[model samples]
Target: ADLPTALRLRRGAQALGGMLGPGLCGVVLAGAGLRAAMVMSLFLFGLATLAAWRVGSAQRPAETTARRGWFDEMADGLRAKWRVRLDRWWTLVGALMMMCLLPATGLLLPLRIQGLGLSAAWFGACSAAMSLGLLAGVAGLAPALIERVGRVRALAVAVQACAVAIAGIGLVRWAPGLVALFAVIGLALAVTQLVGQTHRMLAMPDDYRSRMSSAHLAIAHLAAALAPALGGALLGVATVPTGYLLLGAGFAASGLLLMAVPGLALFLRQDHEGARGWYDRHYPQAFTRS
Candidate 1:
């Protein structure tokens, strides 16, 4: 189930890394001189566009024997499984967890350069360098970590790392430390994103993969949309660092949420037969009610 989707997810991770490299370099060069930045940004933007197109084109999934018309196929897939105690409830719980974390990450974006008192050019350089770190984390670190630790453990660790980095963002009392901290924050953000998405993909059922991805994306964007405005509002009531601290706290709490939620192994699709037999013997009436 969702073998195609797994391939697409891997490709998407690569494409995102490709865009981040040049796009950020251009942003930095622009700060050096407007004309230079503009030329570089344009060139990088063109490269990114091509990379995105390639990723999109590669997503045409090959049909398989189990494939059927989309809607009917999804319905049948859903019916074939024993509904776990938590499967239907997962959407809401997962979305709320992402909402807490994504906004906290987004809140760092605007404040990153300004808080450091660095030239926009330096910030751009960090962006480009950070992309390289992101690529390393995505392509080199992710597979080994996920395989060794399992999806839930990997994701929780990523979130905890992000929370620590977010708190580090508040330590930018000096310019030099701030620049270094921003790079670390960017690194943590990339790793967290990769691990989180992989966990989500592996946790969901095959037929609901796309819908699950959509739900994850929608909540993430909603968090991004609100973070800056909400962070700004908090700033009005407190210091800028205080606002960042609050956002960091939110992300740390999210690590707790992910840890608190039952592990994915408990809901493994392979366990459905055992679950069905248990339901038949112990909770037949409730099974029918569902």
Candidate 2:
């Protein structure tokens, strides 16, 4: 119940930042110059740093009697995640989704726009559209949609939507069509993210949550790092549309594979009490520190 609200607030802030940051940077660049725009960015970064420092100072640090080494902690986190069937499945799903989709938005989209002979302003508009879509999805649309369709079904539908949008981005020549596709991609991405994050928050024990999050981030980052090079290689061998089609197919396949996994629906549908029961039944040592 609370998870949805928390995720909405968090993702909303991120979406707003995404929407505003580029537009502000563009305005600064156009009015002042590249260097001035960069300086403004640095100033904003400093403000963010100060805000973080203030927040950190206000919070009391956790009391720990014994601290493990960083590597040991990370290894333990990975081991715990792998030991749980649900965690393992979702982690892999998240990583693969990142690999397939990141390149489409981050690398290929701009190139596709360029191929259409569109200006940078068009790309900016598409970006803002994506951000607005994400904001709309997370703020109200995702929760209601998830409730109506169910978690697993909603996720499946969102993944398929992303696949279609990405493929359309490659094939669509009109600038408006590209913006619409990017908006669809953003909305779908938001749904997937909300579902994944809510599961993470509810499924893991309190002691394990941060560790599991770190482990997940590491894997996702690795997949994302490799995605750009793979995308570039694909572009080298094929046209932009062909690359998008292949990537979209991979994204769709990932959803199908996830759906095929045993126990996934049950795992995602679990509530807080149900999730706790699941952990107890499946991994009795989940809460026990080694």
Candidate 3:
């Protein structure tokens, strides 16, 4: 729990940054030319790089007696993930969730804006709405909901709600309605991200956290790249409403899929406190002060 608190805090910072960065960037871009904007961006990127390097350098390397081949080490990471039942399930679930959101927001909504013949400012407004929703999820909604319900139920509900929200985006023709839809999608993403991430860290042993996280991120990025293509294909084949409805159905199915996860089954049966109590019984010594 404590180790994952660092992750939770990171998530909160990310949400805040997402909410702030775009508007700030737009202001800079408007006031200065592209050249000045690029220079500012470069400076910020360099600062972020230095911060990341410093954090990485602070962590002491773990001591290991046995040497393993590169393939074996990689395979070991996969096997370790499989051994952690919840992590294993989430590895699949989280990927699908990641895949769905990006395409829906990136391609689908912008497409909607274009179809409506709206200005670039409308797209920007929709994007910012989603970012604000994400901020709420990480800073407000996710914590409150997760604390009241367990992560499992919260995620399942969020997944389905996200699906509905995505579908809503396509159904609406108005800019204001589209912005609201995008906001809901963003909120759902935040809920899934924070709750799912805590589960990710909790499910895997500390030794395997880095490796598992690396694998998950690689897969998510690949899925992200593929998702827009898939969205484009859907748009080509069907009208936006049908495409979005089908996409929403797919996302809804992922929530149903969660019911099959054994660890989540336990969570569904308990409130947050009961869930923690159950964890204490299973891992008394491993329990953090939470």
Candidate 4:
């Protein structure tokens, strides 16, 4: 779609221009260990910061159409959204799943670094590798797997694979091996996110897409917000190893339990007969097909 193309172009330009240039300069400076280089780097960053602030101030609109604050706009949007009224059950389930699994990501890498005694740089590289693995899976591998196995089975396989990675993180003691394990985890996480989102989108009516997407992002953020707090609490009582193992086990069990729910099949089943029967009895369509 045009959306993807535009996004890719924008990202490519930004990455090539800003990120890559700064990154190269930082690496060159760090390698030199020269005081002047460090000072120059800091000066350049300060200049960049000032420029950004000036640019931001320049871009502010001259006038406002509505006097409403952001929170007011959000409240109005929620009230108007179709997904708030429709697909309530599915949205709740999706939110809960996101709450549990998404937070596990932040905990995983820090624990890998601290508990496993790997360098912080290794964590960054592992994160990138995981993202690449996910990118490869999404480009074509996931859909093909779903086609061969069907959605439900594919979901189960992805979760189970994720559990394997989580368990691997817990059970493996060696530091070097974690790089490979994290890559697997990343692959599983990527596929799981893509497939799960696709299923949710397909389950709802077209009118609900915007609200559901909003709900999805909100839930993900909520999960992220809770991660550090929960991780800190766990870290207080147990060693980092124990904390990671418990997190890993919890992730596996939650996925397994969700997959086993009785009504989940009905929610995911690719048929309208159930909806049709329910609609005919309780809330009939406004008009019939000619």
My TM-score estimates for the predictions, one after another, are: 0.63, 0.93, 0.84, 0.64
lDDT of each: 0.53, 0.82, 0.72, 0.56
Expressed as tens digits, the lDDT of each residue in 239-279 for candidate 4 is 76666677667767767776765455554454333333332
Which predicted model would earn the best TM-score? 2
List residue ranges in candidate 4 displaced over 4 A: 1-104, 261-263, 266-290
| Per-residue alpha-carbon lDDT of candidate 3 for residues 192-266, written as tens digits (9 for 90 to 100) | 877655554555455555566676667778888888888888989998777888788777887777667767666
Prediction 1 TM-score vs. true: 0.63
lDDT of 1 by residue, 1-290 (tens): 45424643664476465547556556565467667767776897899799778874445444542455766544433432225334334444444545544444455545656665666555555455555445555555655665677655666676677666666666556655554654555555555555444444554444345543554455556756765667667767976576667766877876675555554444332222333333234323323211
Q: Write the per-residue lDDT of candidate 2 for residues 233-253, one digit (tens) a residue.
A: 998999988999989998999
Off by over 4 Å in 2: 1-3, 57-65, 286-290
Candidate 4 minimal-lDDT segment of 10 residues:
281-290
Whole-model alpha-carbon lDDT for candidate 1: 0.53
How good is model 2 by TM-score? Answer: 0.93
User: Which of the two candidates, 1 or 4, achieves a greater TM-score against the reference?
Assistant: 4
Local lDDT at 189 for model 2: 78
Q: Model 1, poorest ten-residue lDDT window?
A: 281-290
